[model samples]
Target chain A: MKKLMNVPNDVVDEMIEGYAAAYPQYVRICAENKRSVVSSKPVRPGKVGIVIGGGSGHEPAFMGLIGPGFADGAPVGNVFASPPPDPVLQVTKAVNGGAGVLYMYGNYAGDCMNFDMAAELAGMEGIRVETVLVTDDVASASKEEAHRRRGIAGGFLVFKAAGAAADKGYALDDVVRVAQKANASIRTMGVALSPCYVPQTGKPSFMLGDDEMEIGLGIHGEPGVKRGKLGTADEVADSLLSTITADMPLAAGDRVAVIVNGLGSTSQMELFIVFRRVARLLADLGVEIHRSFVGEFVTSLEMGGCSVSVMKLDDELAEMVDHPADTPLYVQK
Target chain B: MKKLMNVPNDVVDEMIEGYAAAYPQYVRICAENKRSVVSSKPVRPGKVGIVIGGGSGHEPAFMGLIGPGFADGAPVGNVFASPPPDPVLQVTKAVNGGAGVLYMYGNYAGDCMNFDMAAELAGMEGIRVETVLVTDDVASASKEEAHRRRGIAGGFLVFKAAGAAADKGYALDDVVRVAQKANASIRTMGVALSPCYVPQTGKPSFMLGDDEMEIGLGIHGEPGVKRGKLGTADEVADSLLSTITADMPLAAGDRVAVIVNGLGSTSQMELFIVFRRVARLLADLGVEIHRSFVGEFVTSLEMGGCSVSVMKLDDELAEMVDHPADTPLYVQK
Candidate 1:
């Protein structure tokens, strides 16, 4: 397809330059690297700083959530691919206060290995660094194997609570624990209508018939748990919600938050249609929903379809969820 | 396409039922009506409640912006169609706090006339009502007649600042003035790659070649001012941003905000690609961007392509832009 770019190779650099230009008040591109950070200068004098790194495509996922009460820096990689360790290290060092730094990222193998290496490298520089991984995609594993499920949209909740805790001056381990607590209480299930082509690869991550959808697909285009005929918004919601709820198993009188997220190509109308059904299904089961958001949260390039995320809430989780936050992708008062 | 709906006609209502069912804590639907109010129960007396309405297809557009400090009641209509007069009246009456109601909506003729009539009907019932129309789509009109342009993605700024002002307890007239001022300072330009089908019509709203784009198209599938071969992300941003900047005429050293929005089917990567370029171009022109957002804000169902919105910012606009507000669709703190 014709595009306005100077060339394919310059796409990433130029894109970063543009992002820095548009959001100069909220963020800036590190002059030393392509990583992004809040424009507000990071504070020093011994406070834990949080840094999150990942590929660029899952917006509001990694980059969109960077700001106060969130990440100090977000090093964006190429589309749907992990960033190099160099940028991660750069972000960690830049955001590390006198106390230490903590790194949070998805459970992707490349991300886990690379970020861990970055954290180790930062430690070598006398910067105390720690890491927490989010793994909340219930469809990727059985309940007994929840730890093995691929991380999906639930990472936002982890990021939000953890960022708030960190912002409130929690120590590195406490922030990590709160984030993990949020992660443990959440689960996600997703379906894909079409495959998203990686720019570097110039090919779809996967393929399905026009009349079908792949359920339980990873954001990286990995195969889903099931490939079935395309269903209505209600059925899609039922299928995804049932999988998420069944995997989580919330009983009556439980309060939860729902996120009906579009992968990429689905419209908000389509997402709302799904939300309409999911809301009804939850109500019929006597579940109380505290907060609800429907949009493209963790998208897979231009892949069609959506994922449902339900975070079973308790008083602590509810308080953390309702806490004030400021981020490019989402915010709450 | 097969959907999870009980029936196509029941889709919108079912979705409303689902929304009310799920977000009972944050919002509640009016009895037997399509309107919803943020559950800050026992709204302070004499508070000027903001009411916004539009067809529901825009996802977070009118409805998504409903929440504390933004809109009190969002009366959603059908897919890409205006809410009928009854819901408009009910929503206005339901959210009116003895203070008076400020009706905010896009500048579509049907919506304007319907909402105007509703205001009159509500006024007849001794409820004070005022209306402010948002007209920020610069691409649809020549500079000489810019006020005639339709409201596109730029309407978000109006919803945001107005909601913030109303939450601060502005009177109905002042709230309308703030929204109008924001709308006046903003201009948007959108291009469509593919037309989306309205389920009610069961057909494409418009058509285009794979290599073409329709610039300045209305949200309801209205024709744009120009249609041409599809361009690169940079080229699209150049055309859209240049038109927006020129229409608003930003001075050197002036600060502004940019919103690069996807028209549904476009990828977030594509929007970012465009955002990167637009930011660079604006920087080159000596404009300082204070804030920026990239996502699917106002969409045309599943249409491909994106829109660029620029709001020339001053202290008031900037403060309002930075004010704390929350809604299902957009948020700021």
Candidate 2:
């Protein structure tokens, strides 16, 4: 596969260096651990610290979500791999302003293990730490076992809810409460039209025939719920929304914040087309779209596909959704 | 080519409909012309109206750049083709406050002819309009003939300068001056690792060998100045900045803004890797980078490549760069 990179092993380090260099006004690498990135904004007293992180390939996710009214820090990992406990500990210590620290990330096995270790280490230092696993992907498990689901791209909104609450000087318990609530009220599904390449191995992550697509494909290119001939944009969108609505039980008069996310390589034109069908389908269902975000939020190294995520917005969640944020990747006034 | 679109012929319309639907608070489709988009914010009484447009494939360019402190109107065209005079006229009328309107877009034959036609029509209607064609692609023309160069990703900075001026309530002629000045001070060059596909015909814009790349490729996947085997990220970035610095003669104590823009399918991992090298090269040259933007800005469907743009920031230009813009794709406070 053709890729624009130098030594593959250094891709992660170089990416962090470049990201920090490009936005020094927003973030800085932790002095203790190079892999950990702390917000340029200093830790505020009495405010709960928000820390997020995951594998490095998904640009502008955990790391990109660091700035004013966002995460206090992000401990980065290697491509498609979780960070070790040391960097996570460093990030937690750097962001702790005496109140406490809150840990948020996608619901992945490796992430859960590493973050749990860091939280244990922080507790030993007299700093309280809380954790919230974003499990929003509907395709990963049955609604009865929603806690076992994967996070995927829908975690953006979940993090938004937590970050907004934390930035508002909410207590540790309150921040954790809103994050868990956001996770519970969300569902996401994605379809992959093409495979991605792993930078280190220089190999395809998965394979798909020219006329095929995998519905509900995970961000890491894992197998999806269904594999079938590639359908039209509307068909694929309708399929994703139908599954999500069924699981979430959305109905008339229910309001939501919708995210039509490009996995990677999929253009904004395609994402908007997908959103067009989604809007039509939701209108037919009598549901109201209070806010719409259509773009590449989470990505898997040049994978071709899109994901649709819906966050049912109750009054509390709606306020969090409209809260202003200033980050390198996302901004609102 | 695998694409996530339905009824290829309706892709453009659907995309626009979805985009407007997604940001109704920011934009509205013109009642007179469906292809024209006007800012939902009514035309400011004394502010110079900023109108930008081109083809459909380049998302977030002319269309996505519509909102507060950005373009007030955008007239979209078919894939890689310029819009007709009707939409342009509609956008001109929609945005023309009592002061006047300023038209800014890339330097292309079709765009020039169509925009000039609209300007003439608007002139007859008693609305004074001025035009500034961005010609920042250094590889397309020499310094002596820079006006003939094709505008590529660097047009973002050019438009930003003009939009900021227009929103600052400058006269139409003053907005045109800064836009022209920005076009002259900026230099951009791109490389293509893969080809893009048009939905209408469903064919590749160009072809490259398995391990080859085209340097200085245009946004439309047009022929580049050089084609050779793919090089390392550092090597390619050095080549691009080397050429830009050569044209602009950057030196010690010089300050500027940098943009490392992904063409389409290029991932942020590769972009950051590229930016690391760019920052290194500029640092070695003793140049002070005032700001840096690294991500996908202007795209050609799903072409895999990137572009580097440098804008020498004088005090006047620096202020414009730091100004606020709240568009759907680009946002700053």
Candidate 3:
């Protein structure tokens, strides 16, 4: 229970309060639905409203991405649990600007169930809500089962492209097409050297021996494909990237955007070390890099590891990916 | 030591290579000095050049801040060790821009000696250089000896003010004055519940019993003023904010910018919990918050703790603080 929190049950409430207070210009807690965070910027009419949500603990993921050029709203949930249909429906309705609403999030069972229910509810009200599930964690499944792969850091690329598309006044179907393409083109894989604690349990969700690492752990401490002694940053990067590129069969002439994400406890210095290897390996393969991002975009609360995500880009995807975005946690100009 | 690095001795070099590769648009390693990181943007003549540096563990601090609206260059060092004079002198010479350069860093003995020597060397070459040491950690010393206090997250404010001032084309002396004023107005304090391992040492730097926390700990695991059972986020925020306000004697109606900085391992959710209390406490005290930043701005490598910094603001300082600055880690527009 070494976490700096109040009563374990109150962590989400207190965190939501703090988040709204800290970034008043960018977001505000939804008055109609306490669990939803809404962007402060006015929604433009006839623009596809972008809504993203998932479990808590992965700060700056679903909530921090809410702004003018990003998600219009995010329904926050309890730690490692999906937001219920009530809040999801509330947020979808609140952000609906007559063009329709798009619900985007990681591909998880609970999230899939809840968001589906929300979409049905919105349909009853004639809101025309669409959904895109991100499945980019290459290590989560075999190539034949790519649709079953879990989403990780690669969700960031999906959000960026979809948000940019919606901001461009694209129709709901067009925005959904862009989001699905972004999700399909991205791949991510991660390694874990340490476990994260759950406040409710007051203990680590999993365990690893000293000097050991897991090759492909999930954000919620789900079992990975392998566990062994920790290797150097270069070795770890090679293993993850090889798993990813093999799954996608990326070509030498492909241009990609790269992201080296820290899973909470990993230092940015270590991420850069990993990124160095990623860049060199891609260069060796003749895969050109269009842009690169390195920092804590997706995280497993205090879990020690890093994830690398690569998104193959075409001209349309490249333009949307490079579009300017300004949010509390991310900014591009 | 669960760190992702190759041969601990080569960590710094690898990190530098990776950083340059990851952020080619923002920075590049100095050709003449391998340890220096220079901004990719061209320096405008007659503007005071800003050079910031320190140890290597605090990622996105010294290096991430090098860009058009921030530092011009940063001399890299080994983990938890001050950089030598060679890289400092080289960076100073390279970013001179025919005007002058301002050297700013935390108030530390090794840094003091090294930067002083660099200034002397630059002086001999007719490259005018001034130094401003940030002393904002209120718990490091008594108010009577405030100048002897250590710098922590508050140093970010000093860098922001100085960078904005220099970007405004202020003379070297004027930029120095603005930096000194910012240093004087800011205060910071932190608490640590776990220790960080140094890659070179292959073990933790310090130890804390389970369920215990040390208040006012230094960035390098230095001893704090008190040790006790870990408390709630609200209680911890109260303890830290009370100490900071008392030392500065901040009065009602005072406006300030607040930063709830994660040392390294603390989750952003916990940071928001602490910040919720910070905003509530300040409101209760009748103090107005102009802007707030909550994240890992400055960090100890994987240390589980957080620091709070407050900068009392006047009109000039407020405007400069809000001025747009674009860097790899920070951007305002």
Best by lDDT: 2
In candidate 3 the C-alpha lDDT for residue B74 amounts to 96
> What does fnat come to for each candidate?
0.60, 0.76, 0.74
Full-model lDDT, candidate 1: 0.77
CA lDDT, every model vs. true structure: 0.77, 0.90, 0.89
> What order do candidates take by lDDT, descending?
2, 3, 1
Q: lDDT per residue, candidate 2, B1-333, as tens digits? A: 888899988988999999998999899999998899999888889889898999988888879999878899999999888999999999999998889998888899999999999999999999999999989899998889988999899999999989999888888888888998888889998899999988877778888898999988999867688898899999999999999988999989999999999988999989988999999999998988998889877888888999999999899899999999999888998
Q: Clash totals for all models, in order?
A: 11, 0, 0
DockQ of 1: 0.51
**Cα deviation of B9 in candidate 2 (Å)?**
1.2
Provide i-RMS per model in Å: 2.8, 0.8, 0.9
Candidate 1 global Cα RMSD: 2.8
Top candidate, metric DockQ: 2
- The total number of steric clashes, by the backbone 3 Å criterion, in model 2 comes to 0
Instruction: Quote model 2's TM-score for chain B.
Output: 0.98
Error of 2 at B113 (Å): 0.6
Can you give the DockQ of every candidate in the order shown? 0.51, 0.84, 0.81
